[model samples]
Target: MIDALYVAETGLQAGQKHIDTISNNMANLNTTAYKKGRIEFRDLVVGREVTSLDETGKRDLVSIGNGTQISRVWKEFQSGDLKATENPLDLAIRGGGFFEVLLENGEVAYTRNGAMKVDEDGYLGTLTGYRFSDMIQIPPDAKELEISQDGTVTAYFDNDSLEIGQIQLAGFMNAQGLDSIGQGIYVANDESGNAIYSDAGENGIGILQQGYLESSNVDLVKELVELVTAQRGYQACSHVIRAADEIMQITNDLRG
Candidate 1:
């Protein structure tokens, strides 16, 4: 009876975790450059619940069934579609990759937000005004600017001439192992492996676009379906608990 209770409780806890994941995905439905998370679970016998004291690994034979456990929850970095807003500074990646932004903490943060802008000092920056790895200085006196899909930055001055620079993108050997630092920023980890530096549209890093933003990939309908499924599963586990309690009550009555 106790073991049955434990099984029901474990199942309920795991289902709650599943519900939590769904909730978070729904909450980030409008977050820019947002990625979805997935939950993984497993089961195995944790210990000897049967009372056969083998105190030694040498004596009684005890068989135990598998119990529940959550293995790992990981993030999916699949690219969302690029939305054209016609904003001069908005940018997006047409394929696989992330934008490199320098953080104030002397760390580099990666994102998918391509909405960029130039500040008063002619420094190239994200929509939030965080400068890219290298500050791209345009002459305040420049007449026009053009950024190529290949991440080449060119500025046309009053002399009808253009100067060029390269925007850098960071690639991790194991991007799945990277950590989300919130606000669409991702920080690398040792498990994420070292960043493999590369140019846009090279080595599978993806091309850049100007005047566009990536849309959130979350589909509310799909998530709602999943949420309904999780709720049903939790209810099923609760049913198990209720059934077990009824059986326990009957046993007590018989004892009387």
Candidate 2:
């Protein structure tokens, strides 16, 4: 009876985790270049045959099955839809790539978000203030900025255009392994492999589309269906717990 209760508890926990993941995805539906998260589960088994030696030498065997557990939570890196924003500073990639951003701690992070803006210091950066990893700077007096599909940055000033610098994209062997820090940013870890820098349209990187941004890849309909399933699963687990408790109570009452 107690084992049944434990199994049900595990089921309840797993259901809750699934619901939480879906909830987060729904919350970020409108976030630029946002990727959805998924949860994986593993089964747990308890009770197995074990040999024990008594003072007089003895052998014993036992077998037990526990329940399920959450094995991993990973993000799906499927490319999101690119929408035209008509903003010169907005950018989007149509393939597998991420923009490299330099963090305040001198470390670097990666993101698919391309909503960039130039600051008073002539440094181009993301809305969150993280500058591009490369030294792509703009002139203080530049009237227009253009980023080519190949990542060439051009500045127009006084009826003249000049190439400033080039923006680069980073790729990973296992992007799903990257650690997500909020705000649609991720940091590479050993599991994700080191960052591979390349031109936007070179080395398997994606082509850049100026005046556009990537929309979150979350599918609202699918998430809503999954949310409902998770809720039902949670309720079923609770029912199991109730049944187990009733059995335990009946067993206790028999001793009266």
Sliding window of 10 residues with minimal summed lDDT for model 1 = 46-55
Please give the lDDT score for candidate 1: 0.80
Candidate 2, 1-256: lDDT as tens digits: 8888989999999999999999999999999999999999998976665667656675555656688999999999999999998999999998999999999999999999999988668798999999998868898888999999989999999879999999999999999999999898999999999999889888888899999999999999999999999999999999999999999999999997
What local lDDT does model 1 show for residue 149?
85
Instruction: Work out the TM-score per prediction.
Output: 0.86, 0.94
Q: Write the per-residue lDDT of candidate 1 for residues 144-210, one digit (tens) a residue.
A: 7777888888888867766658787778777888888777778888888767777898998888888
Give the number of the best model, judged by TM-score: 2
List pairs with backbone clashes in candidate 2.
46-64, 47-63, 47-64, 48-62, 49-62
lDDT of each: 0.80, 0.92
Off by over 4 Å in 1: 47-63, 119-121
Residue 225 of model 1, lDDT score: 97
In model 2, the Cα lDDT at residue 116 comes to 97
